[model samples]
Target chain A: MPTDFELTIRPRKGWQAVDFTEAYLYRELFAFLVWRDVKIRYRQTLLGGLWAILQPFIAMLIFSFIFNRLAHVQSDGPPYKLFAYAGLAPWTFFSTSVTQSSNSLLANHQLVSKVYFPRIFIPLGAIGALLLDLLLSLGLFFAMMLYYRWPATVALLWLPLFILVAVLATAGTGLTLSALNVSFRDVKYVVPFLVQMGLFVTPVIYPARYVPARWQVLLGLNPMAGVVIGFRHALLGTPASWAVMGVSIGVSVALFVFGLLIFRRMENRFADII
Target chain B: MKPILEIRELSKQYKLGWQRLRKAQNVRELIADGLTKPLRMLRGNQNHGPAKQEPFTLWALEKVNLDIYEGDIIGIIGRNGAGKSTLLKILSRITSPSNGTVVIRGRLASLLEVGTGFHPELTGKENIFLNGAILGMRRAEIIRRFDEIVAFAEVEKFLDTPVKHYSSGMYVRLAFAVAAHLDPEILVVDEVLAVGDLSFQKKCLGKMGEVSRSGRTVLFVSHNMAAIENLCTRGIVLHQGKLHFDGATKDAIQYYLNSLSTRFGTGHVVDLDGVGDRRSIVAPLLKRLEFFTENEQPLLEGLPTGSKLKIRVHFDLPGPTLSFNVGLGFNNSYGQRVFTAHSMFEPNRSVKESVGPQVFTCEIPSFTLMPGEYSVKVFLELKNREADAIEDAAKISVLESDFYGTGKVPKNGMFVLEHGWYLEQAADAK
Candidate 1:
């Protein structure tokens, strides 16, 4: 099974260079790492896979009570509980992915120092593991929708697009913070705060409609804002702000590309520094 | 076949010490540094202070060039910090070199350490696939060989159990089995073979032998001289970040040993800091080791073959003093241990703390070594626990001298024994 792969080693190139081909060659490694991450996450726990659903479901309950019951907030859809859970789903996925992926490199520093892989795979695998949790929790989201007598809309076909954008956003930020964590350990302390702060900015507890109309497009630049809004539109059949989604898609793509370049630039020094 | 790997002028420099902090920047400055630097560069207003270079750097490898062909098992031998691992790291692409290039043909995999990506929570079977894929094995390939790998590791019964529960020996075996089964054209192995029991080490060596015989080139780095001699046909010796020798295994080992011995023979008292082979089982108690004449003067140059020689060793004991023995090994220039003498065989000599720094002196009455270059190795053992051992601790050249009254002396053999030969009438041929 010898493919036409010839490895040439030279002095490191400029910061913009990344070796997608080499990463492609180790595609099996990526898959195995992802599998290992997913397996190890739920191993030896009592709740096991159910924790994925329980975490977001419980958070949805608390948020629905606090905002809808106590604060008497006006959510986009009719039932505030359904609206809050829908936004919590993607927001939870993004926050968890960012937090775990940021620490993935430090947790696997032993492997980083001992072996050679793309290094990107560690964080990518972290994201992959959280993605499984997101899917598992989505089942509960649909159950909640059914409980609320929400109609199944044809717009649900576009759900995968919003998920992709969410992944792109998570990966982009994850890779950048993870690479920075290697050199400046302060990134570790910053990640939790970033994730916590991201919740308020992502329009997860409330609808994006609560944000001022003039600031709505600017909120799309947060990437997760657009994803949460898009998820509501697809599932609840709310007319989506196409302009905001467009800005979000563009910002997510840009972040992903730039994150990859920074990750590759910092990669060569990882074995030495980490 | 073309060389499986060609390394040319490969060098790696490592910065040492704590890095100095630069001017603290606010988020505004940080964003400007990342995003707008290119546009600002066009306006030519990018005035900046000269960059402060690192004060010190240690070159781990300097201009090292090596070519490894198919089926070649080259043993890399070096003292600690000799750049053997650095060379392998460069070859494996674990780290990029500071200078030069390496052209590698065919698929290559490196076992810098066994079980590189093994997750403790994963089962043995799961880890086999995970580690295999990490080492570049395809999923189908791992599936095809999964049973073989398990059988080889002798962990078949524990396949479903997490690797964290596996005993260290079982863990190492399972890790090695996955690595050894990788079907790469070139394999780079480090000193991870030092793990496991002796029998398992032999088994791993046998597997490596099979790998090389199957037409794969292997670069093996190890400090075990016997293992190197037994396995590698070619040898490379690295000294202080440079390629010291590259030749036949026999010659390379001899050259490395000679260099160690010569460094020890410089006559000045050797301060025991990073001295001797790190692989020695000794616990490093030697503070100052030296050789002297009977008059306590430092022995320099050559001594007569039949002269009295005295060796003094000074050692510091960090813990409470115990009854210890000072053992010395004398080897001829060919790196063969001619004889070993231990103070345990002698009476009334116990290294005690009351003596301050423990000093032990051994005197040889009429040293019978033949006229040749020789080296000394010293070992300190207390209660049968080896405290320190320095191989090639000192070297002494022996000049020709006549021990017998006869005008002629025999020119062959290592030493002479005092004896009398009586002429007797030979029995009739049967």
Candidate 2:
């Protein structure tokens, strides 16, 4: 038989580029992984996918009581509940993506060690599974807007870009941590701590305007800060923070590049160690 | 004709203590190592210097070369840690090699594990697609063969049921069914046949044979010598991370068997102290195993069929008195357990309240195993718990003998059973 598809295996040198073409070829596998996760995420649970809506919804109610009523935080023109829901939806997506993807490789260690596929799909598929949850939470946010009689504005067009930023940020952190978790194992413990601290640091419970102007750039470096603020500006017609958004996009891209580098460098060692 | 796959000087080196060193340590040890590093450097300890010292390493595979032709069914065999798995892992691209190169001319899918990504919560139908995708099948290809896979697995009634609910046999059948549908130009399988029932195993072997007959290459790694002898046209033996032998299947199997006998000499008393391949969690208690004829003589040449065989197990009991049963299993060269003799199965034969060095003798009245080399497995069980189990503890060869005194030896089956035939006249004939 004549040779049609040839593959050569050899020792890999330092810091290689991600094989985008190969990853693209395995795109169906990526879809299957995502679909599997989504299908089974709530199979035996009593609430099924209602948990996806209830998680952020319940968290929003609690934040509305604690931060709005107890702490007297400003909602920046929208109702405290609406303001909190907008921020909570995106925050949930971002945090869940980070937490889930960080452990994705370890959870699927069998697939990692026993079979050959683009391992990036494990973490990426984890993030992809949460898109449904994000959509559900966003649906509740829009419904809340209807309850408040808030008009749907053209600025809503910017929602997809902010969601993309959140996804990229999650992917960046997820790939790096998942790769590290394979080796260190301590990353598993550290990931929850980091995500917990991140909830407070990101502008989820409070407006970005409340943070001192001097620290706004530092806060924007968190990546999700701009996402939350962007959600408010796009959804509630609040003032846009271009400085924070600019800083966030740069940080998100840099983290993604750095993560891709680390992940690919550690890719070959996963089967040996994991 | 050009070879479909070519490998040159393949090697994989692993650091021995790297995992230990990389493991998270307590803060005190971290501080101590931090404080002593510069002091050790100042004292001129060359061992601590990264440039002067090299971490301990073991080469799992070293400088192996081969050219595999199309339609060739190659069986790879080796003892534990002999690098057969490492070679397969490298070929499967699960792990990268430290050195060497391999050139493949077609799509190669490896089945290092049968159900690589089967989720228990997913339905059987869902897992089929997920497992197929993980094994590198395109979605369209799986869709095209979905009905055939379902029929082959015989799980049409439970296609929508979660895989966790499937019986073990059904699960293995479904997993292997999806794998059998894979139509890669080259297939690499490792011990997947160890699962499923006998009939299913035979069916899988038949499918593999069909695959090879279609002019696709296959690289198989298994410990079952019978399967290798039955299926493979060529065989490769790896010993201590190097290619020990590669030749025709029969010769390769013979060479491997000879190597095993040499490693474990055919002596009367086979010491178990140095045998590391034990499946025991407790301390090593099995000390020695000896085989003898019924007349108290060592059966050096081999045990003849129909003769009585005696096996003695010597063990040490370090703890308080405990009841335990010693069992011996006889497995043929195919790695199939033919029969087992357990002391617990015999009335009033259990050893109770035993401590210190002890010996247990098991006498088989008549060894009816067919003529073949069989490996013995010894296990020490306390009630339902296994205290110690060692496979391949000793080897016994059965020689052909006329058990019926008719000068005819039965060599067609796994065991020789006692039977007699007599001519009978029918009433109509009379």
Candidate 3:
């Protein structure tokens, strides 16, 4: 004897279609989380928002001095300051989001252990917070363009698509790291070293032209590779590098699908396992 | 009315070691290990067993099927580790079940914990919204009830202050107020209320009563017999992961008491060594207990209003010492400690020379007892020291007298001694 009104919720696998309504309902929490992250990062700091721009600005000066001066690296005829800053902006956002989001579960151990909500929001919140930092750094990127009397192109409007690809790459990796961080804490220790290695490998300080034309497509599979080349072309009024941006968009979307699916599947085990 | 929550068969399992033993040295190793788990699953074993599988899971709640109707204030009483919290966790959606499923109708809220979802850095008002969301409330509803929540929590002056700075009273007040004002279709609360001050506890219990009367369901877990009897209309007692009783509230409380009395005597279980396995072939050991009149009819069995009784113990000690202390402690049926008497505290040193068969008696001359059962605990201590040699507690015996004097039943708490008072206004008037 059963009532006809019983509503049984069927549990699903990771890649299964998600109920966006649930995530949408929790949007306020997500927004608050994003805002909360923004405030905490800037609060009580003497430099305030300048801290955001300075990280990349100082990195550009160091890279320009070391790579452009000592290593005598070529930057496709543009100033080294613009080259390094262009590459550093998206790279900084990607790396910081990974570090923050990977440790997101550990940082919110209390919330993760005790409450139930969309777990993706924690890593996504990191992305939202890092975006503010990226925006602040962008101002410096423009100031550099003006300082060097570099020309701006309409191609800059297309920067948003490159940014989307960068974010997809970050979100894909961030979600994987955040979910895995709950169980295997080793992800935290490995992130810094990987970020360092990524900078050199992605040609952030040097020009991609040095990487030989045939090998560039395979190199762009790094995702950030495409983001760097695209930012260089967009800001310097150069032609698009189809070989690099094409590989970046492809890799980013792939990572996005793969990361999101694995993350959703593993989110169910979080409360119990963590 | 249909049950607001139904749990068919809920189970949760966990694995303990690999996360600890196999440390990941780098991202390559981490990804390699993560990728391997799914690969193993694809090799035939499914990965759907964590919620369903405990490596050696012994059904925390096996085939547990129940229906909780709307507006029914049901008490969940159980022994420790009796699956009480597990059942609530499954119903609360804190965790999903392994084998069976639970269908919850309407919004289900659980006050299973206090300060849940609270950010230490967030202000009290902000945490209210955060806490409300955690309990399944919408943002608009939280905004509508925000003022009432602050008023109920008594934190009006400190709404902007971060909750990490609040005192225990303030923290609990706000935590409980958020849960109280959620006004969900069902509320499942655990035993966190034992921490608050007495008056606030009474206020919380009163609010729970009001919540019940307003046609909502509540599943309450508490060791307070009086509060459970006062608030819940029904009770479900769990014993070792099985349903012991599911009936009227009074009968359920009685069933719990009877079972406890049978197992642990009327007194609470006292362990002198704080060790569970303490058994020895002794001289005069403190073994078991019962309260009896001179005729020994189990003192609470139907005695006169004002009568004397002797509490007897059956025991022997494996080893004997000179003047090892033996005494008695008393607690009300509700498990509150009332009084204690020991040879160590008084001028008198009553020592049993031979330890084989010892009998101790406390004569209650003109015993003034109310109508409820009273539990007496036995203690053997190092006389005058803050240590026990052997102890057994919560042995119950009834005092069936009209000593409460108002003809009302004795409430489950420390007894209020009847002392007649006279106020003669100074023989007035010259």
Candidate 4:
């Protein structure tokens, strides 16, 4: 028999039990969800899983042409392809996660109002697909790094922590928007605009050094700001800063916690309102 | 011994719309009473609940409390929105209660929807693994019962086929197969068996009975009384989100049926409580519902075993006919509609047309229904046939006796037939 119990590691009243162990136990399911998301994305189409690889690659090419050629945007040291691909890595993950997770609730509305599961799974599943796509795109990033003849550094070891930070940031934003999407209903339309606006507000096309030091911490609070900076430092041989990574991790965790609390509080109202 | 589940003082209160409306109404009452009228003035103009205002709010489920011991098969019975599904959802931990503490122990799994978590792009075999994992089953256990699940769902041939390619029936079959095989200490299901025709229903019900007999706790929600009566040892009746009755299965069913009769006197519906003061209630009953026989005959006496009895409920709505569904059930001498059919899910009709009144009929080709005393119960729905339910416009019957002796004829079929004219033409017979 399956285990009947999955207690939250720490369940507080009004607290959303992230149920990490429950999530961990459900890890196989999570992986399958990622796989299913990949399959579903390309299942019935003329252009199948290619969309996963094409989405970020095409976006990178456009940004490379427009910003690198037309705008002559600064890439600290590496080639424009390397610069754009690095930014595309996490940005693609973040943007797609937000898109999928937000729509996840409405898409799974049939499952949501009928059966029960950790609702966080909805956004998590949405992100799961993004992560799969990210992994696929990462393959291209590796091929480019080799073409540029940039030897990997130990800083690359720190990449996992930065990805974790990206996940937290993505989850934090996704949770807020998903729950909101169920309510105001218009968040469905607004999320795309915000994501588009975010591509600019973030330093995806530019370097972090361009921003004055006085504004570093505030930018760090953007959460993904540190992530892009961390990725550049890790694979591109840029200098890493302990202060920035620490501050960003702290902000990411805070966003995650805050997002979780608000989601649990509002989730009770979802079935009725949605 | 601890009951498998316990619910105490559970009450869920919902805001109809604007909090301001409730506040304004409260202020009106306070100023009239002259008690705490000053306090009402201080908290002025703030919305108490939602941002919008509506005339009324439905209490889906009110203060309800109950406990279930381990190994109890409890059936929840009620009309569409009477909170049967609400209670199951709360129990399944899908949604939290606005007010109430539910203490449940042991592992929980839900057949609430077969393949609820199934992904369309995943193949049949992959979905089994996916389903088991989601239900908290370990890989080893799922593998052990892998063949059993596939054989039961009867989709072994399409194990590798993407579920998106499967027909609706195949989807349900595979989904139900996985849910049934994944063993859990407690299993919760809600009307999934209603899919895949009645033959499949009996097969699934048999599986549930087997699960129940194995000492696992089962919580079921369904409007089908015959299925409930056959499968559940205990009954729970939820009306307007409150527990109206909780006891023997027979008693709970009786309570539910009686309530329907009281609110809808015989078949007349439209109980206006209007004090004869309003212009007219329009009694949305007779204008929408009626009974007929297969040969275009109006129903007078109960149809014989081989005759089809049709129920046509005609409704004229404020908008085009979005959906017109009528549910008919076979009620025994005890006044219960045992086996019910609905037009809301007609196999060959356009379920989505528009808004308005339309004539909906459930045609039983030859009421292969048992030869027991049966009544025809009619229910009309609009938005989602189940959501927009009209329980009043049904017909009662003092059906013909068991001439074919097929009533209560064991747990085997969706219909009962009065077989006649058995013959064989062969040279050996001469």
Top candidate (TM-score): 2
Native interface contacts kept by each candidate, as a fraction: 0.79, 0.88, 0.28, 0.41
Tell me the DockQ of each model, to 2 decimals: 0.47, 0.51, 0.18, 0.41
Report lDDT (CA) for all predictions: 0.82, 0.86, 0.72, 0.71
Task: Give lDDT for model 3.
Answer: 0.72
TM-score of 3: 0.71
Per-residue alpha-carbon lDDT of model 2 for B103-137, expressed as tens digits?
99898989988887999999999999999999988
Could you tell which candidate, 2 or 4, scores higher by lDDT? Answer: 2
Pairs of residues at least 3 apart in sequence or in different chains that clash in candidate 2: none
| Candidate 3 lDDT score at position A202 | 91
Chain A TM-scores in order: 0.96, 0.97, 0.94, 0.89
Per-residue lDDT, model 4, residue B175, is 81
Model 1 misplaced stretches (Cα beyond 4 Å): A1-5, B19-54, B265-268, B271-430
| Cα distance off (Å), candidate 3, residue A60 | 2.2
- By the TM-score metric, which is better: model 2 or model 3? 2
Summarize candidate 3's per-residue lDDT along B1-430 as a digit string, tens digits.
Answer: 7667776755544333221222456788767766676554344333342221213223456667788878889999865556788778667655666667778776666788778777767789888987887676778889999999999889999998888899989999999999899767778888867767888998898888999899888899887888899999999998756677999999999998777655452232232223232222121246555566645556545445456666555555333445556677665544444566655665565555554545555656545455555555565543232222232244445555556577865554434465787877686657
TM-score of chain B of each: 0.59, 0.65, 0.57, 0.62
Top candidate (lDDT) = 2
Decreasing lDDT order of the candidates: 2, 1, 3, 4
Pairs with steric clashes in candidate 1:
B283-B387
Q: Give a tens-digit lDDT track for model 1, residues B1-430.
A: 6677888998898865312223225676666555654444343333432211223356889999888887888999876568888888888778899999999888888999888889899999889988888888899999999888988899989999999999999999999999989998888998877778878999999998898788788888886788889889899999868899999999999998877765763564766666745223334567777666646667776777677788778876555545667888887753557888899877666545543467788888778888987767788875576656776667778888776758676577779778898987779845
Predicted candidate 4 versus true structure: per-residue lDDT over A1-274, tens digit per residue: 3456532111124555555665666666667666767667777788776777788889889999999899999788888878878887899889888988988888988667766556777788778777777778878888888888977888888888888899999999899889888876778889899889888877889887778888777777778888888887887877756676678888889988888878877786666677
Backbone clash count, each prediction separately: 1, 0, 19, 20
Model 3 chain B scores worst on lDDT over the 10 consecutive residues at B275-284
